[model samples]
Target: MDNSQRIVTIKDIAQELKLSVSTVSRALRDSAEIKLETKMLVKEVAARLHYTPNPIALSLKEKRSKIIGVIVPEIANNFSSNTIAGIEDIAYKKGYHVLIFQSHEKYEREKENVQLLVSRRIDGLIISLANETQCYDHLTDTIDKNIPLVMFDRVCHSINAHKVITNDYFGAYNGVEHLIQQGYHNIALITLPLNLSITQNRLNGYKDAMKKYNLPVRDEWIIHSPIDVVCSEMTIRRILESDNRPDAIFISAERLNIICIKVIKEMGLRIPEDIAIAGFSDNPITPYLAPALTSVKQPTFNVGQKAAELIIELIENNNTTTQYRTIQLDTALDIQASSRRRQ
Candidate 1:
C-alpha cells in the first residue's frame, strides 16, 4: 500500500493491537485510567504509523480551538510590533497559538477581520481598535456569542471587556514638564483627532502642564492632524511660518514626531537652538536623530503580555459572570538632547 494513500487512525491502531477504539483513545491521551504499558505501546505504534491527532476533530469534541486572534491597526509600527512580540511570548508558553490581523486603520477592515477570526472559532480575541473604528456592533456580537475578548491600546470604553492601556495623561504631562523645566515657554502641540481617548488624555496633560507653569495656552499652536504625512507636513508648516511661532513643540504620536522633525529640518531650523521638541515614541532610532529626541515611552510589551494573560484567563474560566478588568500601565520619559536648550 502507498504510504500516503491513507491516513492512520485510532481505529486502525485498535484493530492491529486487538484493543477497543476507546482503549486506544485513552492510551493516546495518557488518561489516568489507562495502564502505563498500554500508553507506551500506543505512543510507539502511533509514532511508527506517522499518526497525528486532527485538531479539527479535537476542537469539535472539546469546543475549543486553542487559538487566539489578535487585531492591530498596523504591524509596521514599532509599538504594535513590540506588543505582538510580548503577546506571542506569553501565548507560546501557555500552549496557545496566535493569529494576527492588521486593520490598516480602516473601520471596514477591522470589522471584517473580527468576522473572519470568529468564523475560525478562535478561543478568544485581543484587539487594539483602529482610529476609524467607532461602531461597536461587531465587538458586542462576540460577547453575545460567549467568546472572550480583550482590548489594548486604542480601545472603546463603551465595550465591556478586559482592557490594558498606558497612563497617557501622566506620560504626556511628564514630557511637557520636562520641556518647561528646560525653559521652553512658548510650546506647541501636534496631536491626533480629539475623538480618541489617548489623544484627549494627552491633550489634557499638555494643557495642565502649561497651566501649572502659567504659560499661555495659544489655541493656534495646537494642530489636530491625523496620521497622514501630507496633512502633517502642511499643518506643521503653518505653525512654523506663523508670526507667533512656538519655540518648542510637543507631538502626541511617534509618526507625527518624525514628521515634525523633518519639517523643522527642512525649514532650516536647528534643533534646540531654533526650536525644541518632545513627544511619545519608542523607536530605537530616537536616540540617533540629529538631536536625540526626548519622548515618553510606554510599556508596550507588558501591555501585550497582560492582554494575552487576561484573554486566556477568561477563556479557561469561561466565567461570564466574572467582572471584567481594566489595567493601566505606567510610562517613562527619556530626556535627550532634542528638548534641551543649547548651552
Candidate 2:
C-alpha cells in the first residue's frame, strides 16, 4: 500500500474496477465503443489514482510522439530567439511540444543532435544548418527514414525538405542601394564565406546593385570573414586602415554588423560623417546604437511560424505523395542615421 513508491497504470485501474485492460484503454481515450457511464467511471478512477499515460509506450503503439525537435545555431542571438518564440506559439496551440537543441555552429554537434532527436522518435524536425556543415548525410538519412523535416534560415539546398527563408538577395540589394542613394559611391561589403547560399545570394545582390549604378566593385572591398568575432574584427580593422578605404560599408550578417561598428568606434571614425554603414539585423538594439544603424530586417517570427506549420502538416498527413514547398518571406529596410550621409 506504498502509494509513493508505486505508479498507477491501466492494468491497475482495470483490476480495481474488474474490467479488461482494453476496456480501460478505450474508455480513457474516450472511444465511442465505450459506454458513457464506463468512460466517466474510468476517468474518475484515473484522476483519483493520479494515473498518467506513458508517452514512450503510446508512441510505440501509434508511431507518433506528438513532439517535434528544433535545432538552431545559437539561441542567444536575437533573431534565433524571436524565431523560437514564434515556433512555440504555433506548436503549443496545435497540441504538440517542442524540444530545442543548439548546434553552436558546429557540424559534429549538429549531427549528434539530429541523431539523438531521431532516436527519441520525434514526430518531425525543424532545423537551421550549422556554419561548419559541408556534408549533409545526417539530413538525408532522416528523409530516408521517412521522417518529416523542415529547414529554415540557414538551410541546405541539396536537401529536398520543406524550407522557409527570407529574400536575402533583395534584402542586400535594397540595403546597398540605400547607401548608393545616400551618395556613397565607394561601398564596401563585409560578408560570410561564399560557400553558404545566404552569403552567395547576398553578395550577388550587392554586386548587382553596384553594377546597376555604374559603380566599380573593388576586389579588396569585398571582404570574406568567418562567423567568429575575432576574425571579423581583424578583417574590419584591416579594411578601415587601408589607404583606399570605402566611404560606406554594407554588412551581410547581424554579428558582423556589430563587429564593424566596434571597429569603427575604436578607430575614432564618426558614423555617416567619416563612413556610413548598413547591415542585416532584426535586433531591437539596432535603433539604440550611438548612431542608430540602418538595417535589412527579415521576418524572423513569420519564418519560424511558417516552418512549424509546414512540418506539422507533413507529420499529420504522413502522405508519401505530398509535394514539398519552399516559402521565401520578404525583408524590410529600416533606414536610420548610420547609413545616411550628412549633407
Candidate 3:
C-alpha cells in the first residue's frame, strides 16, 4: 500500500491542526485542559476527516473499550433471544455496542468465546453460562484481568461475579405444590442435567415440596433429558412406557416442555386424564399449546431488563472489588388443563 493510504492517527490530526499531539488528543476527548473553542474545532475537523478512534490505541491509553460483549448459551432459544434484545436495547441507549456470541451449550465453546471477546478489548461482559460448564478457570480469568463481568441465568457459584437469575427454587417448588394440591401424588421431574446449578435448584425445590406434603419422592422419577427435542421426546417416551408412570410431571426447564408434549401425544394419552404436566417456561407459546400447558412462567422480560441493567452498572461503575451480587426474580405458575384435577 502507498504511504498516502496509511491510517489516520492523533499525530496526523495534530499536524493538520498545527497543535501538539497531547493538545489534539485532549481536545478530541473534550478534556478540561483544552478550551471549549479548541475542543469544538478539533472535534469538527476529526469528524470531517472521518477519523475513527483505534480501539487498540484507545484501550492502551484509556484501559477499556466503550463496547460490551454478550455471550449466550444458545441464541436460537426464545429466552436467550429475548434477553439479548433487552441487553442490546440498554447497551445501545447507553452509547455502547454489543458484540454477541453463541456458545452452543458447550463448555469449550463458551471458554473460547469469552477469551475471544476479551481479546477484542471489550469494556465489560455479560454471559449466560452453558449447562455443560463445570469449571471456573475462564470466568476467573476475567477477574484476574480486572474486567467487569455479570452472569445471567445459568451461573457459576465458585467464581464471585455479579449474577442475575430467576427464583428457580421457588418456581419449581410452587409448581410441584400446585400439582400436589390437585391430587398428583405420583409426580416426576423432567429436567436438564443435575450438574447445572439452575437444574439443582429446581430439583431441590421439587424435593422440598414433596417432603413438605409427605408425598413419595422416588429417585427413578427424575428424568434427565438432552436439549434436543427429539432426544427429549425419546427420553420422555421411555419414562411414560415404564411400569411406574408418574401421574404428573414437573418440567424443570421450559425447552424440555416442547418435546414432553410430543411424547405425551405419541402415547395417545389424554392430558390431565392419564397424566398431568407443569413446566418451567416463559415462552408465550405455552398459553397456546394443546391443553394450554400449565407452566411456571419465569419473569423472562424482567430477567432481560435486569441483566442489561446490571451489565450497564458494571461498565459504568468500573469497581472490580470482587463483590459478588446475585439478583433472583420471581416466577408464576399459569394453570391449565395439564395439571388440573379430574372432576
Q: Local distance difference test, per candidate?
A: 0.90, 0.91, 0.85
Q: Please give each candidate's TM-score.
A: 0.87, 0.89, 0.86
Across 162-263, the per-residue lDDT of candidate 2 in tens digits comes to: 989999999999999999999999999999877777888899999999999999999999998887789889999999999988999999988788789899
Candidate 2 scores a C-alpha RMSD against the true structure in Å of 2.8
Clashing pairs in 3: none
The clash count for each model shown is 0, 0, 0
Give the lDDT ranking, best first.
2, 1, 3
Instruction: Please report the TM-score between candidate 1 and the true structure.
Output: 0.87
Top-TM-score candidate index: 2
lDDT per residue as tens, model 3, 1-343: 8997567788778888999999999898889988999998888888878788888988788766778888988887778888888888777888888899998889999999999998897888888888788887998898788788888888877777878898999999999999999998999999988778889899999999999999888988898888677777888898899998988899888678878888888889989899999998768887787898898877766777777777777777774454678999888889987888855
Residue-wise C-alpha lDDT for candidate 1, range 1-343, written one tens digit per residue: 9986488898878987989999999998889999999999988888988888877789988888999999998998888999999899899999999999999988899999999999999999999988788788999998888889999988788899999999999998999989998989899999987777788889999999999999988889888886678988999999999898898999998778879988999999999988999989989889998899998999999999999999989989973646878899999999999988645
Error of 3 at 228 (Å): 3.9
Error of 3 at 40 (Å): 9.6
Q: Give all candidate RMSDs, comma-separated.
A: 3.4, 2.8, 3.3
Q: How high is the lDDT of residue 140 in model 1?
A: 97
